[model samples]
Target: MAAVPLRRPLDAETVVVPVGQVFVIPERCKGCRFCIEFCPEQVLVESDRMNAKGYRYPVVADGKERACVNCGFCRLICPEFAIYTEEIR
Candidate 1:
């Protein structure tokens, strides 16, 4: 007699979704909060450190760095073109 194999159930909560990669050019940023305010995922925040121009720049928030959804709102809202996102693929 042959034995049957057992399978475990899949859980939706355990699935991991792919997010976008976010890049920030601190030197080009002018301490503007447009990116932070317009980000759909709210993944960016003002960094504690200042840039070369003595301006606070946006960075991936702690514990939420991988939350970006590849949305270009941050890039579009950035008047200085300091921030952008790439799809994770």
Candidate 2:
């Protein structure tokens, strides 16, 4: 066989991609759907039930887990201040 070059394996010093899960507060949400529309990852979903304000709030889907950047934009848009993001690690 002809001689071939081999690629080196990745080491600890290599850059690692970061991933995290998004969390939503059903009780705190006012059902404004701000997070749902504003989320860059499109992870947020509308809940079946409404919040204290009788408005449908945004919620994170259980099955469709996504890597969140934790930008905190949802928290800022939320009038109720119900949504919050945290790092997985």
Candidate 3:
């Protein structure tokens, strides 16, 4: 059997990937689908939860916790102002 080598990042110590802390007001979301549809990273997905308005909200996709880039696109695009992101410094 051929052995597969595990490759690691050469500059893992110095390279910093910006992470975004995503926040969503579940009750404020009216199933607008802006955040889930327009994320440049495509990190948001449809959540199986329903809020007070009986509408599905956006949630981070499985295994994509660190995918957001803190671009503020979701907040800007959301008409309900239900979602926002803060950059993790």
Candidate 4:
């Protein structure tokens, strides 16, 4: 029989997590929920407010501080190029 060494689990709190700041261009948004629907973290939601183009844009969900992971999925899926994310310092 061969012996194997066990690896310790990584602690999530100790890790230097990357934070994201999502930007929604209201005028450019077409009221598509792709950003909100595709967000893995569920950080975004449709805002009751309307843009100049009469489209509902995405806003960060309540109580979702530092929720975005900066994965760029929203930007990629957006047909209007209205949503994007920036890394928080």
Give model 1's clash tally. 0
Over 4 Å off, model 3:
1-16
lDDT for model 4: 0.88
List model 4 lDDT by residue over 6-80, tens digit each. Answer: 865578558676899999888998887988887999999999999988889999999886888888899899999
- Alpha-carbon TM-score of each model against the true structure: 0.76, 0.64, 0.79, 0.80
Whole-model lDDT per candidate: 0.86, 0.72, 0.91, 0.88
Best model per lDDT? 3
Better of 1 and 4 by TM-score: 4
Which ranges of candidate 1 are over 4 A from the true structure? 1-18
| Model 1: per-residue Cα lDDT over 1-89, one tens digit each | 78877765577578565688989999999987988887778899999999988999999999887788886888888999898899885
* Candidate 2: residue 56 lDDT (0-100): 71
Which tens-of-lDDT digit does each residue in 1-89 have in candidate 3? 98889888999999777899999988888997978988999999988989887899999999989899899999999999899999996
Candidate 2: Cα lDDT at 83: 80
Clashing pairs in 3: none
Model 1, 48: alpha-carbon shift in Å? 1.3
How many pairs of residues in model 2 come into backbone collision?
A: 2
User: Between which residue pairs do clashes occur in model 1?
Assistant: none
